[model samples]
Target: MKPDEIVVGVDAAWRRSGALDWGLHEARLRRRPLRAVHVVDESLRSDDFAPIRLDGQVVRPSPIPRNDRRLVDELEEYLAGADPALDLAADLMIGAPGHRLAERSASAGLTVVGRRGIGGFARLLIGSTSESAAVHGDGPVVVVPNGWQPAKHASAPIVVGVDDHDQNDAALEFAFEMAAVHHVPLWLVHAWEVPAPYTWNAPVANGMREQWEQAARQWLDTVAEQWHQKHPDVDLRHELRQSHPVVALLDAADATGTQLIVVGGRRHRLPGLMIGSVARGVLHHATVPIAVVHEHRATEPNPGQ
Candidate 1:
């Protein structure tokens, strides 16, 4: 894989989302080959503002409209002026946003999309294209939240969510690699809540609750120890929280000034459902940049099922 090749999906609402700048900044920093895909809806390519139908499907012209060519030219010039090492290219593809991005992402080192669109109420709803990319992209999808400004120094730490599972190592490794590249620390966070295991004879008994919580802590400690041994030189620290994973991660981000949050993606097996919950939580709510490591395949049943 060419680590220098990064792809970003840009839509008509890109200027409003302001994700273009954030994406370009990262690509320039890494001196990677940048690909910007603008998927035009067929309905948008109309002289009379009428949708165009082709092959039983609407077709929108690719690469943005001629009116927007100036912006693209400006971006190209800025990239060349800011970094001579950066090679930039733009593609205007006509297709479904989600499908086009997913298909192209297989060969990209990274893919970036904005969280929301342009408008008052629409800004509150995450963009459907971005949501699809997050859940389906072959490579890591960077969710640039609305109003996110690229840091000048990029010194903030990388935070990763971990649970007792085999794929947790992938998330940890990704987090450390990011930290190493940015010269920042890594915060290994594990949030645990005692399972509300109950019996038909009675409600959940608190008598054994403490025991279960203790066991959970022990599991976190064991995982943390293993990771620490492997990454001895990495500036790493650990946190074990007795709260919901989603809320705990938010609180940790606030307390630690985190710039990126990482989590594991498990597709199949017994533990699948167990880790799926945490991944979903972060995907939906984590405010900072999220790096979801897609590891598990869907064929396996979730653990404890």
Candidate 2:
């Protein structure tokens, strides 16, 4: 497990070719190793099974084996087909899929997972495992949408959500690096809105909205300048929207034909509060690949902050 390796979750029950392809593309772009991890839940494998009543008849199911090499072999075959010359490794383990992936992400350069899996509901856009890895992982986790092919969007820009605070510095850094790697433009988006209380008064709401937009624009300008200085070769463009964060990000992606959307993910100590609302919303709604980076990983100070 190299620290700079890109870890991609390969689910045995789902079609993860998109994720594998995305991971391979990223690895080649960044010149990093690719690791495909397949985890089988330990709890799901039982040595003993109780008899169950099926159609008024007693039926006993066979015990599931704990160690399964078929998934690992399948993953290796997929990786070989994607790129035989690429640096790739495969890991087969027994544990909760999401939990193991999140743990692996603590030292990985990036973690990639499919938006949905076989266990996910048809209507659900994101699966529990992918959501868990994105929210609970220490580093950046990218959730690749179904049927996504990097070759189709080879020249698409990378979109990143910017906020007033420096919480999104890591996300910005990741987005800028991706943009530089792909030699495409980077769009910095900051969305603002007036408070609901002020909205009750039309005059106050209008004034507050104006003030917020001005402040947002100023902040975005400063951020864009700093990032430009750090990454002079990459093109930087910014936009300020008076709408929800998710909506603004999606709109920016749609308008720019963004291949990847980057946003900050916060890890909370409490359960159910692991992920921020904006990150969760974008994860569930965005059609393109989305990267959720944690702020704590931003070891270096953001310039012009």
Candidate 3:
């Protein structure tokens, strides 16, 4: 666990171009070295490894030798051909891919992985892996979805989902820093929804809606003022919505062609709100990359679930 490194957990899949590029971009901006991680589950032998639909390269059958150097060679060879400018080296870990990567992310400044689909551990990072890393990792996890390409000087905005919670405010800081680094616009979102018990059968009053909206807007404005002073160079936009955080964020990202979505997740469970609520939903469907910042909390997810 190197403190100065950014980890990019990868598979033999070809869609890795996006995640790799993203990791490189962040590493360059953060001025950190990149550690390309590939975890192997001992149970799956070369005989068990097979080609999948998304992977462009046909994976060779796993060899009898379970040597780290062998995989490191493969990782380096692939990286050498892909992009030599990235200051990246490779590491081979023996364990469950998701679990190992989550632990690695705890010390990494950021961990980048593709939004993988369900399958064997060969891909290493499935949707579940990304979600787990985002929720449990001590740092931020960026899940790059398929078809997402990294732009060096992105003009598109970076969206941050902020709430009254301390964790959400942390996400705003990340969004501002990323936007400033890439010279892009920054969008802040604060979404509120009526409690199910309140909205289930009862008709909401116009006055109630107005009061809630006004209070939310005021809160957002106050929060934004502090960040604005800190990051005056970043083009900032803020919105308050009476919709689910997931819907408001995704819709905003799609409308603005946002480059990245930054959300906060508490390592410990918290009351009132959930840590992965908006982050998980967006990761499953977002076309853009999502950065889930891991913040610590003293609580847990909703007990009802």
Candidate 4:
């Protein structure tokens, strides 16, 4: 199944169904055809065209019995049953699951993987696969956590964390798009760094905190000006904090009852091996869905400097 667009990344785990719904939602949002990919271990070395079922909570069962039960067939049947409006296709690939899916994400508008995958990627647990997508994938990566049901979170706002240390435009773009699509509000949160004063002057040290707090506001205002102008209808709100970015981000998401948290990684000098601390930190701690957008410009210096 080689159709040209794949916006959702999925595996064969039980969570695959949730991943499917996630992809469908994304397709509906972008108004494009949807593609679901299943990447098995290269050792299996076979393009799987076997039958499967989509109605059941699990994948390997006879819930929807039929002779021509290919993986994509089950998905197509499910999509058709679910909604005839979506244009969908699917395929199979044999490779290292995490890296292969991340590689596939290069051409996608966004790559979404489940909290847990199956096959080679699932062995090390979902963290490795989802983190690999967030850290190295070319486009933005959305990690749907366990028990992620859209019905429950449809009304929640989208939260984005920004700082001067890394690029924030990509995050803002994603957040605004999500807000616009769901007709929800967007929360723009900025958490500044608190470097300790080098000297023993307590008075001067106390002044530094105030200066940094002021800087955080300026950073939020600058980014907000550009983003809010483009999305005039979005209910945009901002927060400035002197606490750790990760803690602030998680807390803000919780306080605002947000369903998704969007963050950005700084451009790595080596390109494939590194990611920013804030993005990595929130990935492990946030209870809601997480989307990590990579820095768009390699030459753009960290604005925090």
Candidate 5:
């Protein structure tokens, strides 16, 4: 699907620093509509209650319902102010927040949620409903950190992690389009390890060491040069080292100010059955946001093309 047709899912809570601006910024770049969603979980309604003993002995203490509609109204107002021309809708649901958000993501091209949501500061530090959405949502999920302001014009570049063992053309193309639309740089990074000789064996296999380094450098050059032809305007950089892909990516994020790290996710149905090593490493340790493109559909574009 084209970026213009993308449905951006916005999980807005009543906060002023909501994800509406962030989501709208993306929509503006892609020329897509935004769906602002507010989930009012019954579980969060109230917990304070009193048992009735004798007749009229004790009155029940009922906690007030969370003002879900107010949050939705506030979100609509924010959306209206953020982008007056784009198509937008606000949905309020009474169910499990995570499940509702995931279901809403079914048709969306991407989902955006605040790193710290309405509940307050503690939620940001720990695992949040947003994090759950990111891990399980069908489409690409963008987790906006606290104090994140949507640029009137998006500036952060699209960065994709390229693995020698995996098919990355799909992700690279995705990043390319995003970068092109946002008018930002595109960085292609490949991180590989140098073979280390086993202890009690040779301290250094001099011949093998030289060959390994040469192969790593050549791989980076070839991939960068090949993508450069298609994305000539994109500012590209390459990093090849003995460290792990996860570590290398985090380091690169700091050095280059990467906004998103697009990587390919495993396509297997069963859990823990077919997770790739590089993806697994990235899932656990990458510092920046991730875009995991799955490989099940034939219509999905190839990254090289």
Candidate 6:
């Protein structure tokens, strides 16, 4: 049986080579096919058509261009240069990139995109496409930093932010899988802080902090033990920190030279909503690749079920 394809968003304006490389790496590790997608927003095109240059000749866009030949050529060239043996496909789609990629994620095992795209301003740290995919994609979405080459940090461990919510199960599972694939260690980090109301009272705050720390440690221990039993080959380690989730994750990632950081993406009923604050913050600030896995997808039955 064919494995689920790994979909990656490709853009000519942004530094997308890194994203493609990361997608290829995952595809090889999971023994899956890689689909490189480039979406053209017709609404942004002048006169409902965008001109293209192919083979040193200007080609006028048709009423409905199914696919860009230039893009397909570029994708094929990249694959040939990167890995000739991998099963790779190129798709040129028309619509909003984020929405299109999210739709593709419905059947995809994983979706990968660059942290920032050309649509947003220079000051924007995270692009709309990356954020939308992470928030709305069906499964795990990995946002790779621009110009980030996976080979540079191949020896680093996979760091995952663990919490009390059930959503963290997906993140932990992905982290462990990645660690196993890369033959590296896995670090599970849980960060906690006393509530603001309790912090107002000094004595109460002290006691509450201690309790919270103990609870966090116990929870981390339980999670670690369970995952260790499941993945005996992974060198799994756990840590509890008294800091903000974003801060703790970033610090742990930096300290460990992490290759990838995994976090849980909370599902929202409403549209146009951002992902969880911690995931958003880390996506904006971290220089490393970040994978946001949705809990609903985690609970879903596997294919052919």
lDDT values of the candidates? 0.70, 0.83, 0.73, 0.72, 0.64, 0.82
Question: Candidate 3's residue-wise lDDT over 159-245, tens digit each?
Answer: 998877555655776788889888888999889877565675445644377777788899999888888998888888998888888
C-alpha positional error of residue 289 in candidate 4 after TM-score superposition, expressed in Å: 0.9
Clashes of 1: 11
Of the two candidates 1 and 3, the one with more favorable lDDT, higher being better, is 3
Please, what is the TM-score per model? 0.79, 0.88, 0.80, 0.80, 0.75, 0.87
**Clashing residue pairs, candidate 2?**
none
Best model per lDDT: 2
Candidate achieving higher TM-score, 1 or 6: 6
Q: Is candidate 3 or candidate 6 better by lDDT?
A: 6
Question: Clashing pairs in model 6?
Answer: none
Candidate 6 backbone overlaps, count: 0
Residue lDDT tens for model 6, 1-305: 13378988988753444688899878877778888888877667655457789999987664544345576677777777766677887877877788998888878878899988767798887888888887888778899988888988888999999878546777888888899989999999999888788877989887677778888899889989988999999999989899999999999999999999998876454565536788878988888999988765556666568
Residue 147 lDDT in candidate 1: 69
Clashes of each: 11, 0, 5, 2, 2, 0
Question: What TM value does model 3 have?
Answer: 0.80
For candidate 5, write residues 1-305 as lDDT tens digits: 33333333344443554356667777787768777777766666665577555675875554434565566776677677776788776777666666677566656677766655656465234235665555555556565555556563256666778877767776777778778877788777777665444423454655466677688889889988998898888776666766688777767777777777777664454544334556556655554556665543345456679
Alpha-carbon lDDT of model 4: 0.72
Rank all candidate structures by their lDDT, best first, as comma-separated numbers.
Answer: 2, 6, 3, 4, 1, 5
